[model samples]
Target chain A: MMHSLLVEGFGVQNWTYVLVGITFTLYIGIAIWARAGSTKEFYVAGGGVSPLANGMATAADWMSAASFISMAGIISFDGYDGAVYLMGWTGGYVLLALLLAPYLRKFGKFTVPDFIGDRYYSNTARLVGVICALIVSFTYVAGQMRGVGLVFSRFLEVDINTGVIIGMIIVLFYAVLGGMKGITYTQVAQYCVLIFAFMVPAIFISIQMTGNPIPQLGFGSQLADGSGTYLLDKLDGLSTDLGFNEYTEGSKSTIDIFAITLALMVGTAGLPHVIVRFFTVKRVRDARKSAGIALLLIVILYTTAPAVAVFARTNMIETVSNKPYANVPEWFKKWETTELIKFTDKNNDGLIQYVADESKNELFVDKDIMVLANPEIAKLPDWIIALVAAGALAAALSTAAGLLLVISASVSHDLIKKMINPKISEKGELIAARLSAVVAVCIAGYFGINPPGFVAATVALAFGLAAASFFPAIILGIFYKKMNKEGAIAGMVIGILLMLFYMTKFKFGWFGGGTKADWWFGISPEGFGTVAMIINFVVSIVIMKFTPETPKDVQEIVEKIRIPSGAGAATH
Target chain B: MSEKSNAKAYWKENIRYVLILLAIWFMVSFAAGILFKDELNTIRIGGFKLGFWFAQQGSMYVFVILIFVYVRLMNKLDKKYGYDA
Candidate 1:
């Protein structure tokens, strides 16, 4: 169906080159504009970040390369059921802003492990917390590296592995030099690049197709396929006619959807990098204010993602039908050579059906490349494609830097401060943090070149690990007065191990092959984190009930954090 | 430990507010999206189905509203307890 957008005499090769050049210069300029100073500045932007600036940075950090690249892919394939990711991600922010942000800020910690250690009054709990944080952070960062590789490979025609390394170097320079301070400012700039890149193509397509200025509302509105049916409703008719669930209807097990959504919410709150952003604020109230603002900015991108997916899919079907294969846009030939997109004229009609198989009813596009392909499928210009390439890079690099910082903080701040050298000077520990950042970048680059799955699919595992281990222990420690160190440690260890088994069992098909019939109440690996979380909560509560109470001193510590009072001023 | 700590009373009240708001949050998201979706679907606003909208856009808008509500409520809670720091 998409083979027809190519007409004789239209070529955008030159325009693509110019757009890519401008985006690169803009990012470097913005990075220099928001340079870092001092260890304090490097770590938390000197705790002087206005909620507005911080919001933009946090939005960039939170959205990541996956949201920009893979979310539309997911929506394009899964149709209306894909709204779960959209709702889960945006909804998770509500939990972050209200339930977790203020209390963690009041604890006044440099990292997530620091808060867990202090709250539980046990180094054992801290160690477990650090391990979980590392696993989640690394797994997610690896996906970002792969995205960076894809963007670089597509535009520059560099080796994919080389592109990954290039991304690592750029990220390492700023993240190592400036820490949170540098990353924050760069992320704000990155957000601007990404959002503009996303909206420009979307707006162009919407205007061409639906005469609508807003790409978001255009999703549910009628299509311009000249078919005179609502876009989703047409997709519904197309897919359902071929035996697919209607585009707006859901077909997945409701239990699985509920569980996966739960896991994602907890995971978002538990992520160390995102939570640490709150600690950058001066006052506890400011932390709450910052999260509110951060969430507002995040929604701007998150809400628009699903809409873009629907618009792109509807346009793709009409664009590709009944035309010669060579007549498809030059972008298809271009992307196909990269192996990012493929075409098969399913019905042997010399035209892509794109509709569905009567048996499966699934659209054939690779969800990972949906955002990049959407512009071309809609037959927009080449500059938008180049902008998408740059935006994908920005998304990948910003989150990679954020995750790498969290890993370094765990090593130098928690592990080194407590175990390696308890008496290490602050100056020395700070150096260790910088060195740790470099090491993490190298490792993430390695994983990026050799990725485990499509970018978003890979990061979803990180969310699972976070939900299973960190979320439960932290929430219990903060809210449940009876939860003690032993209970927390036991819960985290059990939660993480169980989640690992769940993930490996399916991904590797260990113990015979394929998905098991009995998956601890039939929860898919995608939703295992939610189940593990509930288990952790239950285990901690049951054990704490039988064990002795939290020590009086620990109780007092909890009381202190609960109050919104002084961390006082630091003269530095 | 100090005479003017004010923290103890401040914490007690804050906990109450969080509990109440969080309960509403869960009901809107989990309950409305999955648990009571069938019932809600029967009630549509305009061309959009209520249950689907809740799952797609409604709950998110509500979640945003809830946070701002939390912000105002927390501010009032802070000022009332004389712990606005």
Candidate 2:
């Protein structure tokens, strides 16, 4: 178990140990420094986090390991079709800012279920919200934990299960100790480390590719190798030459791309961890302001992703194409041992001839390795490689901590305090939240050891599920006064069940077997959430007509949440 | 204007701004990025096809601008309605 695995005969194990050790130590130190005493402080950081600080925390929480480690790899492989992620993840913030964040802030709640329960005047609505939150957040946290495991296994030479347990223990210490207060402050530090770590190597690669320091401009500038060709134009040509789709043109059907993008956007808006960040700020106005700032911070990394993808893709082609298998670079050899990048001489030519056709193509590379291996692929220094590892860990840990907090809050604050035992004291609720955090972390760690799907795919499913379940309920609750509790509860159940059915049928083929050819209107399972959301909306509207209106006080509360006026301190 | 009327007027203005901003949002992401991408791809901007730019990079820029526009418009409306924090 303690055997040393050499990466290129260099002790990456030592570098990873030092860097990860320092970051984990620093994070725990911050958690101890920022420990919360009261439930209010623990849940929403006493509702006094500055807009800028809160924005940074929100960005860190929102951008998970999928964004840091796998997104560039996805874009590299999917080409223009990958734009769905870029547009979907960022565009959802607009919905959050305009439709949800401000009103939720005015409601001044500890958790998203608090709003659902109070707004609908039904414990059923609250419990439904709590369940959806747990499903989405736990699914999300499991993916992040897997990301943590991946970084440790590759960098520290530890097994993936050990990495997951280590990540869980560190997350439990901070999450149980500081709660949201600790998580928020720690995330701000994480944001600084992650963005800087993400950008330095990107800048280096961009300059090496196009002679431009800015990755964004470098993506469009002429190749620095004196090819006199634009970077994307070169990439598109290389891609098409290999039978891959043009780098800038959509390959998937138009409707599928549209549906997937819509689902991710709506799901992002409905996410509990992201929504809870809005509650930490003091006022409705600050909530709006914080969302804009978060987007600004997130867009910096997001916009860089495509450029990095292009750089990684172009470099990969030049390095591997027409080269003998024996001459493959050290990085290529290293990755192959992990089986993330595979090569077989189908033609027995002893040369690496990569093509889009799987039958003839000998080189197969997993998309997730592209970002993590970018430094090595470019022959960058070891320190930069170590920094990338640290950054990936930070991104994964920050998101996992935030998600565990939400899962704990939904269980403790919403389910236990609100329903199971209404007379639970403040101290008792705090203990329950901490206890739930420990249990949720253990569950998430288990999932990390046995992840269901690819990191980005599982994360996408989390978003899709959230969109299908929570987005409609919360939106209708705020905007439509006549939507009764019965309608809301029924809509959630119908929406989530439809999504689960489609996903299991298509993605897993759980009940008998279903395939893409049998897809309804040719919509894939990833995009099915969009259709399910429409069903939720339609079902809610139709059911509202047949049911009685919401109570008068509930209508008054809805009106009160809309106006920014009378927003006082959040009650414990 | 009375407080209730002022609040009503402010709410109307807020809705108007949200509508206009949402229109821009819809155009950039759904329309230009998806429906009109092929048409716009005929024209290249810098190294990116116009449509490709909108899909990967351009739409995100527009979204950020849209949010700030909402913030600015809502802040003014809040001040008008005496709801500014």
Candidate 3:
């Protein structure tokens, strides 16, 4: 039946429409079925979600379009330097499980700020948490919205802006109606769709190139062509031939790699959306189990990514490097129309030169195109390509909804209920939550359409901001009973301000815009978060020493959170 | 044991497990994957250099294992402290 549909002129775009249509309808249906009836359900899925389901939802929420689409692409380009993301991202779960998640679940809060406010005994700290969450989440969401636009523009042939608007509407519909309840189940379905779509192409290509079905092992095995050459060895040779660094070698300095890895790990632990997922589960033990399950699911993709990077990089260079322009395959031409792949034919030569030298190279390919173009480059089936489209949308939309939830929760629960309108009723707060989600979606859409100059730097900025602002506060709140509100507030303000100052100065060339040579202690802005984090720790400790001790009640709250029993459920 | 001291004991044991687990985490990612990567790269396992594999694949696998191990240890601790409920 499927082959007959294709034979009847149902092309890639048609298949994409069908798959995406089905998935979108499924998401909407799930949303309506699971719509939240109260503030608790909207905020934390009523705090009765099973560990297995929560794990799946967390996995889907964590792996954004960046992970699904851009990670492999970036790894394909950066080679060994890209290890920071792999290790950095997955490593954070260890910290989350061990250091953060269980205790936060025990605290039984609706949001991160709720913990901050109550633990520190101040609305000021909560307000700071809210601001930092908004900054990190909004910066992160812009990239996701762009991912949605990129997929729609390429697959569905819609205008990028139109795609952003469409994505905004769909996200608003589900996020507002179902709240966290709807988002959780929809994300579970999305995780399945995305992982299947990601793996099928990877497995097919792995078998074709290396005769191994497991992509992780295939990347480390000898090629299938009986050349007895290892895949990585062959890629290294190909890279050097084009004047590029050896495929397995690192060009980034050692300290920068360490800093970047640390920053990402800490940032991952601090992300409010991911941390909030644990609050939905029933017990402290379930929180820990669910975190483990989430990481296990996430690693399935994280581990496969490098292998996919190697395969796609090797395949891309072999197909296009030094090849005649006229003989370029159909996929290249298709991508050319999207301007993601461009050929200028320098020196009036018909051959495509993809050399590392910028002046001499005539083929310019966007790194974001590698994963989307991989199946097509390998001559996979049309439905598989369409599957990638739907999968990309699933990844983007799930993460966007998660972040939007955090945004709305911050506004309605933290800012309005806790700060502005403490007398507001439960029903009023629920309405406020939904309305804030609608407004947040619009702002996210605007950024997606007219992305800021720093969109490319967003991952670094978001993670860095989270690392700098949230990690120290939460960790201190949990582990140190004496940590007072003054210390926490001062540490966060200084930490975030330091990160922002460094990022804008280095990334945007603000404040007289120093170059690479002037980077403090040879750390890039991407890695500056690690330094800022340490400073937060030091400042927090020193300030705590000089300031008044935490009140007896708040200290007792800390003692209570440390114990795993009696975690019951997350409550306001 | 008194309730306050019992809680303290549980907390202390939990911290010990975390520190040990976090040490392994640091060793795998920061030490093996980054600081000693070049040294480890001299050794190869099939097509993968030891260090590069650790950076890209091995450390992540270790991290997953570390979490589950921590979970097991914590669950045991909870049971011992009568907090399993």
Candidate 4:
């Protein structure tokens, strides 16, 4: 059962052990220090976390397994066009901090539902928020668990399914025991490891290729080989020569990409798991500070990704081109066999041009594999590979735990307790939350076993859903004074169901495998979510205008949320 | 009421920045991807066409830098309004 890589001198066993030891110890340390007590502690760390610490945790939370592993891989293949995720993800934080974070913090809530419920004065609005939160969190978490399985399988030498089951157990243990307080502290540690792991490879690779240790600048700078062309430029040239769109241009319609980017940007601002992080800070000022810090940390990774993409592409292309397929390195052959890196051997020359030949060029490699495969491609030592394994696992496990807690919260906090049993006790609700986390993990593990094509695509679907469903409600609830209960709930339901229908119909042919011709308004599922977002906003505004005025007390609430006045020392 | 005028000025200033920033966002992604793509194709800044690079790399770097710029500007504005924490 030993994989060939394990057989080859990479003692993945030792490396994996080191990785697990460090992660387990870190999680344990965080749990003991940031112990939870009241339900508030479980929900939002009792609003006492420092801006820097919250920022660190937020960075880790925001940069999931896909960002760590697949971003560069995607960028390498996607070229400059792939910058949407990088830009959208990072830029969205600015919108979040300026427009959303401070007000949400001042609202002083446990979850997004808590904010929506209190704001609209309706159980229905709370329930709708809960449903949207659950959908977005679950869809995102499933991918994270799958990422854990992949990393564990590679490093621990276990079957993927076993790796997933083990991951589920570890995530469940910490999440149930510590809740937000425990997860936040653990995530701080995860941020350090994931960023260091990401940068080390980039740094090492940059030094080798560009003779520069600073990866951010070096990637766009000229290659060390003195070819006069920057690594990025060379890559675009090489790729386009083979008939691919220049790495920086669009092969798809511009409108679609524009729409998708907007959706992702808004979606990031509105994500329940992400927004709820603001509640963990002590005050509105702390929330804004935390947002700034989070943006700072995220930019480091986000900026470096484009460089990593160019560097990785240049290096990968150079390795495969013009070489005899047999004489290629062992990893090349291994990847080829797995169909991760396929060559058509055009002209039967026994060499892969790896050019972007539109018709005949079949130099197809799963873009997600690029980041995971980097250490091996560079022929770095085995420990780096093991370190990567650990990094990917941390990225996956940390985010998965966060998402599952949110899902379980939606069910226990917003739906069952509020609607079905308003009389539910704190203890009973707590127990229900724990049980829900376990069930949710099991379901996520199932999807991990059968991950849908490309992690990025799945994540995009999650973002689109959030943009369509929760974003309008949250943004409107904060900015508009007149938004009412019925309007908010209806907007959420219509937006969510419409987005889901569009996603399923286009992505899976939900209603009898509809063809492309069946697409509504030529909008792909990816773009449809943005359109749905507009509908929600317009509908909410128009309905609020027509409806009777909000309760007189509602103005007081908005006034309270805006003022950074002396609320006295924040009591946890 | 005078304070309200001050707050209104602050709001207008913020709006101006947003409008300018939005233009950059559009030019990088939408304009580069659609309208100006062919124009960018003529200029090879290294190995990539300018338009393609904008879509993938240029816009991202600008976004990161913009966050810091906004932060700096907002901090100054906050101090002006006595809102600095």
Candidate 5:
């Protein structure tokens, strides 16, 4: 198994080690090249990146380790229901481009809270915005670090804790030194590495399975083994035979899925790390164009994910179903060592059985392992395996760097400079930002070593929190000129509290365990955010109607921002 | 027309474009992908059930296209309004 691969001097581990070393050096070099010299550069890359480069960096920032590593696995296991993620995450960009990005760019802010603060003209609203940003970004960074740890643990044979620490150090080196200026350029490089790594194995697997080189088309193509069956048809039949839902159909309640998808869409638009990227662009037009190009770059991976899921699912069934345990492939055995995949002879038979019914199923595979183990499962060359390892690291590091930057900015810019010490000098603020990044990376590393939840689930909570809290507040701040400070603050507090209450009540059983039946409208905790967001809108509109009008100056600023003109240099 | 009227008219046109684009965005995802998914699944496209395709693949493509379309339409609108950067 993996031991054999490790025994050879020029094996997969060696390749992975070399590639990771080279990639890390390249990223650090970029960081050094793009090093920040001013507060503006530290926060927003000196507001100078082109549309295309910003688009690429935004794509890298948006597509986290969860998207690269676990998305395909989730699709494979969850069947058609997983489409919620693909659509929800991507469609939000449309909302960003049309509704938020242009106006925010015209406003010319350094951070998301800056928009909320100025729009509402309230320090309290600004503070609330910063809290939400920190929570969402911190929750998200922990998952990226865990993704880094997982890849390192499997490929380098390091303990997960050591892997997390190593990842933290590397991110700390680039993120603290380079700031947004450094992180932005490094992310573009990471995007190239990660996407190349993602597509290679997918192309190989597709060619092997259906003689189709394009993974997107391979899923719908006929089997290459003369089976005269569409690949999905084969997977559907196999799934039904194994007591699983049909591959192209869903079994979850439609309402729940709908709510979750909506939550994720708004959440994506509301994300601080993503919103802040738009601030780094040179002009309002670049902001609009960048959103388009970012989605296009992102689509390259998002479109391929379902195809990878189909191939992995079909290959796994064909390879392992009804097979004797002793004859299982090396990849399965290797994954079993990590306990991500488990097998039991339930019927006292030596064969493994994978089925939907727990009583009859003999194999238990964690969904997160699918992407990490995919290249090995396909029996691709050692170099491809090494590439996948490097790609996963790139995905994890790129996202972690973005999230850490936002966290640092929230601390240094929003909390310290704006709230606590308004007179803090530019040099002092830059020092605080770098210091906050170091501290933030340390906390994120701790969470990576002791993850609060599974990678995708923890990331989902972050999305839900963002969707409920920030999305409504910011959208109202932009689109509803009459939305006053009182309405904005009230809506955000109520939205976040309701979401936290529901998640804690359901997810952790705080104030006693709440069952699905106890769920209001039968909405899952993941979907509850959408409902909470609705409540936020209702409360804000109602409160705004009863309150005094927004100040004349605030209304004038809103009118000006909507026009996308006079976007002079952003000032402190 | 006064400069104020020009800005006002331009904002109106911008809103119209956004509404049109967002309508398509909503239909493809929430309608074709979810509400009409069962009916769409009754139809097939290559190896894909139509609803399933919209859910996992089709909607995302439409999203990307919509944004780019927004970009193009906005660029024209910006030029007309003398807001081109």
Candidate 6:
């Protein structure tokens, strides 16, 4: 087999080069073959994508490097508290399928701002939508670029800056050349690559730990070593032995978890890039079906994540706890060279103590390295380790390409065609789209190379901002005919400003930088989106009562979208 | 039925379905997974605490099922309303 041939004599780094080369070639080939020819094709893949293909594309677009690399890693450390992300990220699709996708598909627009501008009958609302989309997409994409760089620097042994530049070039080639048509197909290929890459290691580790091939089931099964103790029971025992919370017991406040989960779900539904995927499908029903398919595909990884977390966490603790630094495995040293895993012999004992106590802890493991190092820790073959690098790249690049599309579409389509120069020709607009794409990729590349101090905080804040600004406006616009331009604009402005004030104050320590105890109603910045969204809903409705009703034709358009009968190709 | 009322009926039924499904969505994720987690954790299936299972695994599976169910229901409604075309 090609796998065996590749693994036979090549080192892990060499295998990474071969596999990454193959996958990148596949993506670029698809881009060249499926290049967009018209504005419609560029914006929404000519509005002819099959449901299944769109589903796969959306899955790839939705699951970023955070989902593939960091989610399991974070879960490994957070234990039961990690359920917030597991439930939060996936639950949003339910909201999308039920409340958003079909209606947006029926509206038949090129961008989220297009829908907002037309639905609210105001350029002001559209401009706000464009700004929000840009902020969310840009913040989200920067993280993805950094993720790409991280994989490259670790696996391929390149400078992180060089890795960023290479990733930028690849994404620029596909996104600028192929547009949505190109991105959609490449993402389908990427989804396959990433899912396979994720599952292979997980399945191997699951069987090795619990004698179960399925990771989801194996996490709840007994240890494979003739120990009758259940895996979670053992993990809980190990955790408490090391001064950590029990594996299955959460430490977060219930209200905070509820708020965060709601924020992420609403945010997922409100994200412009994910919503735009529905516009590519042929019909409203297809939109609904594809949302289902996307979530199903996403759930495959989401469910396995906690399991991988358990296995990796257990393996890591057993391998390093109280063990001599000299006896540590080669993988630990390799990661240590990357500085992601550090062992400081504070006690001068030369043994690695990985206890939870801040004063006594000797080993510091960065959460981002858990998934990347999982295969190696399990003694898996070099090829599987290389496949993970390729997978992480696939995750990062696909999401970056998706967010770049949103950024460019918000600019050329929303800012240029709608607001700035309505007289622009289709050809002119397509050129504008391509040019903005190039510019967006450059900016995204810059951020990747030189990430801002708040890149991580901003990525989470992107969700909060989306949930704050977009979800309420879109929801009221569809469900309530009385929703007017004045109401939505006011609601969005206040919601976004409130969310920004809260996030910056808490997350960035700006605006007189408050601590966690100062959080409003005990809701953390991550979960503040729920409060902002509720306020937006209330502000929109209350203002709508005092303001003028929606114009007659706009109400009729709302009626049309509700029926879902004729979801034709998206237009300008 | 008149077109106006016909559209209204379709939308109303759609909203009803959405409400029911969203209720299930909330039940699994927020209620069982968070608010009532400690209560549910008292019960265990295999090595999994019921609430922890819901939070980490069961809620996601239910979410996928909910979406597909919504799709199926909406598709049937569209057909019934003669909008499937």
lDDT for each residue of candidate 4 in A1-572, tens digit (9 for 90 to 100): 46775577647568778887888778877777776675667777777889899999998988898898888788777765576687677667767876788778877777888788889998778877887888888788878877787666655657778888988888877888888888999999999888888888888988998888988768756888877767766766787776777666646566666677787888898888899888888766677778878877877887778778877777777887777776777667655654567767767888766665556664778887788788788887777877877788778878887788788777777776777887888788877777887888888888888887567788878988998888888877876767887778778888988898888877877867576577666656766778999998887777777787789798568755665434332221
lDDT of each: 0.77, 0.90, 0.94, 0.77, 0.91, 0.92
Badly placed stretches (over 4 Å) of model 5 are: A1-9
Looking at model 2, the pairs that clash are none
* Residue-by-residue lDDT tens digits, candidate 3, A1-572: 98897576678999999999999999999999999999999999999999999999999999998899988998999999999989989999999999999999999999998998999999999999999999999989999999999999999988989999999999999999999999999999999999999999999999999999999999999999999999999999999999999989958999999999999999999999999999999999999999999999999999999999999999999999988999999889988898989999988889999999999989888888888999999989989999999999999999999999999999999999999999999999999999999999999999999876423357667899999999999999999999999999999999999999999998888989899999999999889999999999989999989998999988998999999999977777
Query: Candidate 6 residues A178-220, lDDT tens each?
Result: 9999999999999999999999999999999999999999999
TM-score of chain A of 3: 0.98
**Per-chain TM-score, chain A, candidate 1:** 0.93
**In terms of lDDT, which candidate is stronger, 3 or 5?**
3
TM-score of 2: 0.97
* Stretches of model 1 off by over 4 angstroms after superposition: A1-20, A29-37, A224-228, A321-323, A345-349, A358-364, A569-572, B1-9, B42-47
lDDT for model 4, on a 0 to 1 scale?
Answer: 0.77
* C-alpha DockQ for predicted model 3: 0.92
Task: Write candidate 1's Cα lDDT for B1-85 as tens digits.
Answer: 5533566666667778778878877887788876777788787564345676677766777777778888888888878876675
Looking at model 5, residue A550 earns an lDDT score of 98
* Per-residue lDDT of A136 in model 4: 88
Per-residue error for A126 in candidate 2, Å, reads 0.8
User: What is the per-candidate TM-score for chain B?
Assistant: 0.84, 0.92, 0.98, 0.86, 0.96, 0.98
How far is each candidate from the true structure, as Cα RMSD in Å?
3.7, 2.7, 1.6, 3.7, 1.9, 2.1
Model 1 interface RMSD over true interface Cα atoms: 2.0
Leading candidate by lDDT:
3
Q: Runs in model 2 with CA error above 4 Å?
A: A1-11
Candidate 6, DockQ to 2 decimals? Answer: 0.93
